[model samples]
Target: MADFTYVSTWRGFVYVAFIIDVFAGYIVGWRVSSSMETTFVLDALEQALWARQPSGTVHHSDKGSQYVSLAYTQRLKEAGLLASTGSTGDSYDNAMAESINGLYKAEVIHRKSWKNRTEVELATLTWVDWYNNRRLLERLGHIPPAEAEKLIMLPSETMIWQPEFTDKTLSRKPGAVQTGFTRHAVSWGVCHPNIYYFHNLTPGWVSFNGEKPEIAIVPQSLHRLIYGPDKRSSPSLDDDLVVNLCTSEHLLVHHPMLEGILLSECERLKQHSLANKLISLFRQFGGTELRLKLVWLCWLDLMTGNSLDDWTKNLKHKSEKDLEQWIIARQGQSEPLTNLMDQYVLMAYRTSVDAAHS
Candidate 1:
């Protein structure tokens, strides 16, 4: 005995319905939508039938227009799946589906905000994957749906062993350049700088310079190849060159390999310079605006310096708090400071949400 579940996300609104098997808490079907369309419910029912392939499984949902639509009823008859609709305004009739919906909102939707249809779609996909594969359902004896399915399929096989392997190798070419470099890397040192030129050497199977010539030896397999490093131990010349060439703006705009190493070094020095400037400005009776601007600039520098999506989201969160605290803690904080902070907080929150949804 199994049940089918249909859930819809209508412009951020979600509706979940299920038909239960009294004997077994098996979920046979589910659907999702961003609208209160009959198609959504129908799709879910169709999917459930596909899942169970049970010749006369009862499909049940609330008395929504979508469920009562001619097309929906026709489809159910065509498939030979029994259709059952709950009585009007009877909460108990659709309790199971409502419970599933409540769980979905509490566990997934309420935790974050979605920006658009695409974002909602992606989030729904992730939620479904988690629910079906990772979630521990108490009804299923605290096992994931997929795991439970496996157990049923291979009851005699007590232990399902999955072999895993790891390859410690970089996925990309050793020295691949970032795309869109021309638009953003004009002031950067290695916009189009040749790695061969940086090394001041002709392409060949040789290690012409270093403390240990043999140790620094260029592997024949790697030499003369555009994206190859001499060996795993040797620095990736192209990536290194890009790092050395990166200015602050360049680093902010381009996602180059080794950018993190270069930006970290740049930031260490920039932080000292900024500290000195701030101290000097404070001594010189700088206005609040100037101090605030400098603070934001430093925050932006740190955010862009990291160049990773997760780090940027974290920086956004920290910056929002930092600005608020800076204004409150500072002695001469102005009214305009509050407005400025509001603008940044909103923007950061939006960006963070977008990044998460993305």
Candidate 2:
């Protein structure tokens, strides 16, 4: 879908609209556009009707001007399909379609940097194919829509097992007990010595046998004492300590000395101010990597520079393309730059020094 959009950019701004079958969740019709004109949506709807040839199906949508247009209405009437528009502000009416748009934004547009419309169109084609044939649908029981439909067409039978349990007896012993409810005897093994026993206490229950149950009971107030609030949710030593140790050892082996380097670099960057020099260096390098490195360098530089203070504080108000342009400009170039990484680092160091004094 992104590729389609990119390719369409060669001509002008374009939007790709599709009519997906609610039952099968397959895109039955889609059309690319250089404009949001009614024709684009109408063409898409026509394609959908022609492909599906549905005798009668509810064509549901929000009260978008395009869908409400005379030409769009005529096409639906001629095809004998019901045109249903949800209330003006009700999102539920067109939630499924909206979700499709959200998915396209998150999974495709968010991830890539496209040069043109042609690229967007091509990417869109690949995305659509994967979505239809490969993507799993939770609504369809974690099966792809096409596969789930196939299964539904051919019914099958299989056996399923379920287990049920009930208490057989309840008895107590003499003063081996501690209280009316003997702490030790209340346990399954102590209460019913002959029967196979199991612990059926609630999650926070405590036991103090010669073999201590591997459960820690920490008071809510004292939670910070052991793990602190942030680390409290982490697995305790009793929970898979061996597995945790093994994972730690494996990580160390796989990336030997990486942690030390990371720590040293962090400490060094913290003490060193290189904000202006970093930004200038980034401007010199100009590219994706250079852009990111510039951002980091800029942070350090800002820490030391009075003039460049809070430069990006209002960045949230900027458009995405504007932000990209700003990043590119900081690198002192734009896309299609060469030897970007080295240039970026050098420029960053220089800029940081300049900004610090300025």
Q: Pick the candidate with the highest lDDT.
A: 2
Q: What are the per-residue Cα lDDT tens digits for candidate 2 across 291-326?
A: 444343233232223244324343444555676576
RMSD to truth, every model: 22.2, 26.0
Candidate 2 wrong stretches, greater than 4 Å: 1-12, 155-358
In model 2, the worst 10-residue window by lDDT is: 169-178
Most TM-score-accurate candidate: 2
Q: After superposition, how far is residue 135 of candidate 1 from its true place, in Å?
A: 1.0
Candidate 1 per-residue lDDT over residues 167-206, each given as its tens digit? 1222232332222222122112122232212121111111
Give the worst 10-residue stretch by lDDT in candidate 1: 349-358
